[model samples]
Target: MCTQPAQTEEHDVSTQEENLSETDTALKSIIADVLGLEAATVNEFTPETGLFGHLPELDSMAVAGLLTEMEDRLGFIIEDDDVDGEMLETYGGLLEFAHTKRVEA
Candidate 1:
């Protein structure tokens, strides 16, 4: 019984990690597509990689399109109130936001 419970717990953690990975991949694709960037360029992004003000391609106008694509592709609605600089500050920040929204959805 102890081993069974442990196995179940491990499985749950593994599943959560898998889901996070999927969200990360999906987000990278969305950013690349929205900004007309090469997939390789987006794939090179690390958690600490700066976005928003850092990325020349992700200007104010591009932000709108990016959020729209994120909503359509991720199947989550992002209200105006949710728009914040911290969410777009780094690659990790965006991934976490998207993963949280995805899990909520």
Candidate 2:
């Protein structure tokens, strides 16, 4: 009889964690490039890192450009209603949004 290796819950969780980390790094790089900020600055962003009104570089005009760049780079579309303050409130919020879009795509 032939048998296949069974994946454990721990393995699934670990894989998900790794994917989240990769997504976070990719999102940070995209944000830095779109906002014309240094990659190091984006790398320093944490969950509490405020965006939108908090970042001078991320003004209203820049928001449109950033969303366009994100769609181009991340292969996802942001609906008009999806463009909201909460999604851009903090680094974690943005990352979570990106991850959700990616999964949907």
Candidate 3:
């Protein structure tokens, strides 16, 4: 019985990891598509990859379009105030934010 429970826990963790990976992939695709970037470029992004100030495609004019695309792709609603600089500062931050929204939905 103890071993069975452990196996079940492991499976759950694995499933969660898979879901996070899928979410990350989807987010990268969305960002790339919205910003007119190559999918290959977005695929190279790591947790530390800079986004807002570093990416010329992510300027003020593009933020709204990006958020709208994110909402459309992720099937989540983003409020006006939820648009913050830190949320788009790095690839990890955006992934975390998207995951949180996914969980909340």
Candidate 4:
């Protein structure tokens, strides 16, 4: 008797979402590395948690470091308007911004 192979399930996210997810992952890794956060991973910090305030490791210097790292990693320019705390209010927001920038670039 012949046996049938098991079928695999796949997600149906849009291409934009997939690209955003990839960018988010990279951003999360960089954030974790730069801030030395102990949240286990970037997902630990939600959009509600104020990164600069909630994350002790995310002071001014750390923010600057993170920004620089992001610039180099994403291969794009960060404008002054992009420095608003709102842009980084949460992981979701950051990911959204990154995706937007990626498309713009």
Candidate 5:
């Protein structure tokens, strides 16, 4: 009988971490491009980095543009109801949201 090796949990976790890293990179790039911020400044964003209320560059109009860019670049549809202050509150939140939407798509 022929059999294939089963996937290991370690391998799965490593792949997941890699995907998260890629998602993080993409999100940061999108944010930088949309807000016209330096890539280095955006690269400095941490999970706790406040986005909406804190960043003067991230106004309501900018949010709309940002989301549109995200949808185009990330290949996902963000519904009107999916938007909220919390999702745009921090880099981590938006990263998580993007990851979830991409996986779902």
Candidate 6:
């Protein structure tokens, strides 16, 4: 019953960029949420921070949950083969993963 006017492809691309920024922010937020960690705590999450070593909250199950949230929220599927423990090891790596998705999209 409700329809909006179509946008130009350029407009759509701009919207997608905004959405990607939102996704990055949401990724951090969801990481904190799923990890049951304070936002500030995740501010400390860097690529070399040792996700598994540093965060006791991050285990196999949590990893699965995080991946699910990412897939659901960002509209991008994370293939199992696309990542490994090393990629989740730090904030930089996580950023890299997100960047990869944007590039792939």
lDDT by candidate, in order shown = 0.88, 0.84, 0.85, 0.73, 0.89, 0.75
TM-scores of the candidates are 0.86, 0.81, 0.82, 0.74, 0.86, 0.70
What lDDT is reached at residue 87 by model 3?
Answer: 90
Comparing 3 and 4 on TM-score, the stronger one: 3
Give one digit per residue, the lDDT tens place, for model 6 in 5-102. Answer: 57676786787688656766777898989888898887666556666556788888998898888878766788879878677877667767876685
Local error of candidate 6 at residue 45 (angstroms): 3.5
The backbone clash count of each candidate, in order, is 0, 0, 0, 1, 0, 5
Q: Among these predicted structures, which one has the highest lDDT?
A: 5
| Candidates' RMSD to native | 4.3, 5.2, 4.5, 9.4, 4.8, 6.4
State the lDDT of candidate 3 residue by residue for 31-56, as single tens digits: 88877889998899999999999888
> What lDDT tens digits, residue by residue, belong to model 2 across residues 22-74?
88988888788877889998899999999999989888888888788889878
Name model 6 segments beyond 4 Å from true. Answer: 1-21
For residue 69, model 3's alpha carbon misses the true position, in angstroms, by 0.9
- Candidate 5 TM-score, C-alpha based: 0.86
Candidate 4, pairs of clashing residues: 47-90
